[model samples]
Target: MDNQVRVAVADDHPVIRMGIEATLDDISFIDRIGSVADSTQLVALLDTQPCDVLVTDYAMPGGQYGDGMELIAFVRHRYPDLRIVVLTSMEKLALIRGLMTHGINAVLSKADDMSHLRAAIQATRTGRRYYSPRIANLLKALPATGSARLSQRESEVIALYVGGDSINTIAEKLQRSKQTISTQKVTAMRKLGIETDADLFKYAIELGLTRKKPLSD
Candidate 1:
């Protein structure tokens, strides 16, 4: 049927991928085209397996395409027409907002009922954005000093730092001056009210911003 939604699922957890695939299998209007366990397999799957919507985990490490915002950015750039639904356990509104900024179609909490996955797929299928109830509430309660207050460059700097890159390395990789990277890091911390490097690392981990495992090409 032309209206049937072809869906692909990607997650690092075997059980999560299985459960999501099982759920998709029972949906009348959806076709579970394929499922994979990492970003590498996902990239290969997408390269050949056409799908209408992709339901992927937010923190899937161990793929050549590093996870988090980088993986999302890669997929969005490589497959501009593919609709993406980020199924993550991440609760920080700022992190979620970062995903949204990269043009994802939906963000659903893993805590939400599996049924919400269907709703997310439906919403994305029609080109509308969807957020799970829990995520929506978090957005409603967004604090003024939240990660959303940080500039895009600040967010990038923080993610790279928490991922284990030094200031000089980040500056080199980002093609910015060391002073600019340092300022951005300090400004990001100030915006988030983090007074120390230790606090910043802890906050990044809490927000699921730790550096992902290195991508192996």
Candidate 2:
């Protein structure tokens, strides 16, 4: 049809991808262009396939294009006209605000009903932002005061630190001084209101900042 909205989906999990694709397929005005399992595939598909809307998972790591806020920023810049809807299970206000900052058109919680996907896609198509019920409520209920934006370096430092990397090792890996790494960690923790390493690890795990298992103390 002339007015059909071409949509592509990207999610690392097969089940979630399948469910989203199925939901997109069922939408009357949506044309399911492609569905990919990672950021790399999504970028490649976007390069070749003309799409109007992109529905992507926020935590698809291990892709050369990266994921989370990084991937969203890249896609928003690369395809300025394409509307984006982010699907995530994260409940962190900081992460949600970060996605919005990067210009995603909608934020939909994975826990929301699959039917909400259609609404999100439609809203974005019309140049409006959409948040699923749970996510909207979260935004309303949560205080926005401590949602300090994490710099790219600080985000990287937190991910590495929470993934069980020592300050010394992270410094060596990132080619920075150990003191600098320690400072970054401390600053990131303070911004995040994380009081201890255990809480930092929990925060990382909850936000899907890193895939590595938490280290035992």
Candidate 3:
């Protein structure tokens, strides 16, 4: 294949990894370099391997290098030229915004069809931003939580929480005190008119807050 786009996939689930590989198999221009099960291995591969695009799951547990935002940040810093396509189930606008702010090339939801992945990969390989249609709709539909919009810090707090981080974890990651993190969470929830954690999750989903989880095996 001439000018083939080499792609590496990082996903914990064997099925999802294989599915991505299989999807790219039909595209002659995309060469599947291989797949890794965690962010640690993905980073190692990125150091030793040459790839034009990376398709990685948002959350892969059991890696010392961490997952989600941390790993994304690491990759962006170390491999500035590599195009990143994040595969996630989370619909959180704040989370997506955060990832975009960090310069991720593309984001595709697991719920969307494989065609979306194909488009994302193609667009990203060419240095374009690609967001799944579902994601785009969610972004367009985002509304103010209450009488006032959420502050950047408040949105960051809720985004981390929705991504499965605990209050302490969020505080540690954000370099804020636990009380401050908790207060931000509460404030964000109140602004969204959410009284309970469960309701908060639902509200987040309603507002396109995507839950970051490993693809099902």
| Best by the TM-score measure | 1
- Model 3 agreement with the true structure over 88-170: per-residue lDDT tens digits: 98876656765776787689988888778788988888889899987777666655554356799999998888777889889
Q: Can you write out model 1's per-residue Cα lDDT over 1-217, one digit (the tens) per residue? A: 3888889899988888888888888899998888888899999999998888999999898999888887888988899888999999978655665676677769989998878888999888788989999988877664465535678899899999998888999999999999999999988886665678877775665445784354333
At residue 90, give the lDDT of candidate 2: 86
Question: Candidate 2 lDDT, tens digit per residue, 42-158?
Answer: 989999999999999989998988888768778888999999999999876656655765677599999989889989998999989899998898777644534567789988998
Candidate 2 local distance difference test against the native = 0.83
- In the order shown, the candidates' Cα RMSDs to the true structure are 6.3, 6.7, 8.6
Q: What does the lDDT come to for candidate 3?
A: 0.80
Ranking by lDDT: 1, 2, 3
Q: Looking at model 1, which ten-residue stretch has the lowest summed lDDT?
A: 208-217
In candidate 2, how many Å is residue 72 off?
0.8
Model 2, residue 76: distance off in Å is 1.2
TM-score of each: 0.70, 0.68, 0.67
